[model samples]
Target chain A: MDTIIQTVTSITWQQIVMMVIGGVLMYLGIKKNYEPTLLVPMGLGAILVNFPMTGVLTQTINGQKTEGVLDVLFNAGITTELFPLLIFIGIGAMIDFGPLLSNPFMLLFGAAAQFGIFFVVIVALLFGFNINEAASIGIIGAADGPTSIFVSNQLAPNLLGPIAIAAYSYMALVPIIQPMAIKLVTTKKERRIRMEYQAESVSKQTRILFPIIITIIAGLVAPVSLPLVGFLMFGNLLRECGVLDRLSNTAQNELVNIVSILLGLTISVKLTAGSFLKVQTLMIIAFGLVAFIMDSIGGVLFAKFLNLFRKTKINPMIGAAGISAFPMSSRVIQQMAQAEDKQNFVLMYAVGANVSGQIGSVIAGGLLLGFFS
Target chain B: MSAALTQGFELMLFGMGGVFAVLFLIYLVCIALNRIFSGKPKE
Candidate 1:
């Protein structure tokens, strides 16, 4: 009776607060339909682990040793970097890259959009995070959840929970965040600018060779990014190879879904009230928004800059799609363009930039690894 | 600037420069591949 009372009374306000946060995340996931698949599992995991002396995580029970399922999964998945890499395979399979291949110039926006990662690293440092922690937090700007997780896991494991939460939450808010950033930077004239989308047919051979050549280039330039670039390209190779249809389909569907569940839950292990309920967590969230906003501003400004030298002006709105939120960023840009003029169809160009952002985010992760590691 | 600040600036330069260089190379490669393999013009 006394033991039960002690256990019940030991529940601090911090744990209660964490449990409420978890509930809110679950509510957001189920009710609002914002990243339901990831948020639901992550929210549940956060709640489960916060229960005092819970066996959901590895803990010594009474006297005998015990290992929790979440801990086992975390050790086998996230720490090994297997989950994120596998998730990359699914992402790679889902991406067409055909649009990007047709309009390669969009790749510039992909590169430009990554500016926020480095910019925010400086900002994070100013906020008193060490260089490594700053880099990990700054990578939240990469806007690619797996890359953010992978980098934070490698560089600053202690901060992984907050960083991962910030990365995914901000990604879900891209529709809101990107448009505000775009409107702030661009004029009404710039917003209404139209782009001509020419449908260029890419050959089969080019499709097969793209993943291979890109892997080589990225590997050579930033050898540190090879695991990230390699796994992503490997998945793309499965997609483009034509002979691996079964594997590609599995990767795009079953493999991604399963890994996402595991990854989300495992990430929650780090969300204990001890680590999450802190001033730095709030600061990381704030910096993540800064990173995202800066990313949009950077891409739009670069596009506008390019217009200075070219006879044909590229619609600066496509630049905002260059963040690595994938189809979401692309879709947001397309919708924003349509809002200004229904006739403007920039989806293809936006997709091109979006795919390039995917690749750019991975490379940026690797570059940070190289510099900081 | 402080040492950490200096490192941060260097990282920004290298990171951005590296991304652009690699992606630009990819751009050029894609253009070349398209030209070589796109075949004869269709009527």
Candidate 2:
């Protein structure tokens, strides 16, 4: 009772603000449906850690140190960089690289869309962050939640909570954000550009070899990317290997769900009022928005540039789908296409681009790790 | 003229180049794999 009274009386304005922020995140997660699995737990954690001398973080009672679950989880899971990598395994199992393997041309858009990751490196640098910090923050443009967590955990751990929030929040908002950026740079006729997509027959050998070959290529180019690329492709190998359906099913369903839940809650360990209320946090959020928007613009503009030389004009919106926001970016592009003309069934092409983004984001993350670490 | 700016540009040039280089290689290899392996037997 004494501790409770002391905690209530001693609570600072920052703590109060953090609780409010936590409440807002909860509202968004529950009502607005924005990355609910992550946001809900993260919001609750924000509220959990903010009370003075909160029990969720390590505390000394009578000069005896007591371990907090959140802190323990943070050290075991995040500090070791285990959670996000584990999440990648699940993501890999869930993804079908068939869309990507069918059309090699779409892979270029994957590389092209990564313009935002490097672009934000400059933007963050201009904002006075150090190289490693800038690099970690720049990864928000990967638009991949796990990649963002993985890179930032390695480079700018102190900034993990805000970066994670920004990555996931913006990803959930892809439906809203991407269309705005797509429409700004594309013409109605460009949006209406139609292309034929025939389901190509991919050999089982190609399917099995695809993950293995890409893993080798990633390893050769950026050896630091091995853990990330290796783990992701390992999951894909499990799916494609034909003998591991049971394990693949486990990875896609149970493994992903459990890890994502823990990963979501674990990231909030960094969201304590003292760390999360800084001026720099606001800057990270802003820069993240820039990264997201620039990524879409980069992809859209790339397709437009290609149209200049190609005899068969490509829908510039297809380029925007190159963002690793996955089905959301793909969905946004297709929706815009259908809105312009209902007969425009760009969904299959968008799926191809979307899956390409899955690979693109991991490579970009690996490259950032190689450069900085 | 800042060190951060220099580093940023260096990253931009090489990073974009590296992404394109690696993915472009994958593209060529993917094309080859289709021709070499398509219509083959399953395991």
Candidate 3:
């Protein structure tokens, strides 16, 4: 009876709060359809781990050590950095580099938009985080959840939960966040600016060679980024190779779905109340918004700056699509353009910049690893 | 500025510079490939 009472009373307010947060995440995922696949597993994991004396985590049983499934999964998948790399293969397979290949100049927006990662690192430092912690926190601006997890895992493992949540949450909120950021910086004229997209047909050889050359170039330039870029390009190679359709289909579907589940649940281990309920956690969340806003601003301003020299003006809003949130950011830009003026279609250009953002964020992650590690 | 602040600025410069440099190289490669392989304008 005493043992039962102790077990029942061991539940702290913090644990209850975490469980509620987890429930809210699940609710948001299921009802709102916001990253349901990731949020549902993460929410369930959070609730499971927070239950008093839960057996879901590794513990001593019968005076002997026994491994919990989540712990085993976390160790084998996340700590080894296998899950994110695997997810990259799926993401790489899904991406069609055609838009980007047609408009190669869009790559600059990808590079420019990453300014937030570095900018927020500086802000985080001022807020009293050490260089490594600051860098990890700033990576939330990468707008790529896997890259955020990969970088934070490498640099500041303790802050992984908040940073990962921030990255993904902000990614989902791109529609709300980016439009607000874009609206604040750009005038109505800039928002309504239309650029003609001439579909440049790329050769089959170029399609196949693009991934190979990019992987080689990125590896040579930033050797440390090899794992991040290599796996991504390898996946792209499988996709563009045209000989591995079955393998590509598996990578895009089964492999990604399985790894995403493991990745979400394993990441939830970092969400224990003891680690999550901190002033630093709040700061990470706040700084993540800062990073995202800065990324949008960086891209927009760079585009505006370029427009000064070019006779044929580029739409400044396309720059905001350069963050790595993919179709969401691109879609937001398209909606905003239509809102401003009907019959203005810039989705192709936005997508070009958007896909380049995928490559940009990965390289930025690699560069951060090289500089800090 | 404090030592941490100084280091932060240095990292910002290096990080942004490195990203731009890498992406610029990729851009150049794409351009070279397009010029070399592409036949003529389709439309």
Candidate 4:
């Protein structure tokens, strides 16, 4: 009886704190609907991992300091680059490359948005982080969670938990972050600039060829990116191949849903209080914002440069969507457009650029690995 | 340290230039295709 009481009393304050944080995450998911798909599972996983002496988290190894279940899972899935690539496959299937095909110049916006990745990498390094860790932190600027996961897995596996959390958290907060950045950068008059939409319907053949051509080009140019890019493009191919409707649906909905649950919970298992509540984590969060802001700025500035040459001017606000947050960033641009000029335009152009960013970031990730490795 | 910074800077430039050139080549090909496949205007 005394042993049982002492065992109960042995539970630490840090575990209690993690339990509360888990509860808060659940409340945020159910009540506020802040990224419920990821947050709920992640919250539950955190709770499960934080339980005292569960023996679920511990493992016996021949020669190991302390093996935990999550540590093993992390090593297998995340450190090995399996989860992110699989997630990309689902993302690729969900994306419609038609908009991108209609306007290939949007690729420039995508490329430009990556300025933040390198920029923040330098800043992080200057702030005492080594090259790999800095690179992992900088990828948060891509406004892409999976790419961050993939890059960090390759570049800095130790930073994976914080990097993944920061990436996803910022992506969910894009609707809030991008608008303020857009508004601060562009005047009301510029924001209200109405542009005519060009009608360029892409053929099914073109759609089918796009993934193949892009894969060939990217694979040739940056072989390092093949895993992330290959998986993403393959997923897109599944979507665009016309006869593979069933596969595409499964990839987009069922596959993504299943993987998201597993991935989210797996990531959460790493979020122990000792690992999570750190000074570096705070800096990571701060720099992640900087990276995101820079990506937006890079896209916007590049669009503005294009405006100097092209007769058909694009709304600079749409450029902010070039960070690969997908429809969310595009939707923010659309909402901002509607607020400024209801009849101005929609976010199709931005969506095109947004998808292009998705591809471009993958390519960049590959190139970084190629160059660094 | 300065040398490392220079090397990093050069690396960054090379990357930026490399991707830019690739994007440019793709653009040129796209433009050329647009010109070739875009038939004469309907009478």
Q: Residue-pair clashes per candidate, as listed?
A: 0, 0, 0, 0
Give interface RMSD, every candidate, in order: 2.0, 2.8, 1.5, 3.4
Scored against the true structure, residue A111 in model 2 reaches a CA lDDT of 82
lDDT of 2 by residue, A1-373 (tens): 9988988898999989999999999999999999998899889889888876756888786688888889999999988889988988988898888878887788888888888899999999998899888988889999999899999998989999999999999999989888988889988888999988877878899999988998898888888888888899999999999999999999999998898888888888888889999999999999998888888899889999998999988898888788788778888888889999999998878888888888888888988888876
For residues A1-373, could you state the per-residue lDDT of candidate 3 as single tens digits?
Answer: 9868976798799988998989988997899887887888889888887865656778675577767778888889889999999999998898899899889999999999998999999989988899999999999999999999999999999999999888988898888899999988999998998888787788888889999999999879998888888888888888999999998898899999999999999999888899999999999999999999999999999999999999999899999899999889999999999999998999999999999999999999998999876
Q: What is the TM-score of chain B alone in each candidate?
A: 0.84, 0.77, 0.81, 0.74
Candidate 3 regions exceeding 4 Å error are A1-6, A60-64, B39-43
Computed on alpha carbons, the lDDT of every model, listed in order, comes to: 0.91, 0.88, 0.91, 0.77
Find the 10 residues in a row with the least total lDDT in model 2 chain A: A52-61
Task: Please state the CAPRI-style docking class of candidate 1.
Answer: medium
Output the lDDT of residue B33, model 2: 93
With candidate 4 superimposed using the best TM-score fit, by how many Å does residue A363's alpha carbon deviate from the native?
1.4
Which candidate comes out best when scored by lDDT? 1
Q: What ranking emerges by DockQ with the best candidate at the front?
A: 3, 1, 2, 4
Model 4 C-alpha lDDT per residue in residues A1-373, reported as the tens digit of each score: 9868865796678877887877887787778776788778778877877765554466333454466767677667777778778889899999997677677777777788777787887788777777778878988887788888888877877777788878877888888888877777788987887867676766666666667766777778777888887899899999988888899899899888888887888887667777777788889989999888888887787778888998878888767777888888888888889998888775788888888778767776776677678
TM-score of chain A of 2: 0.97
Question: What is the lDDT for A278 in model 3?
Answer: 95
Off by over 4 Å in 2: B39-43
Global CA lDDT of candidate 2, please?
0.88
Worst 10 residues of 3 chain A by lDDT: A53-62
Candidate 4 scores an fnat of 0.09
Model 1 chain A: which ten-residue window has the lowest total lDDT? A52-61
**Candidate RMSDs in order:** 1.5, 2.0, 1.5, 3.1
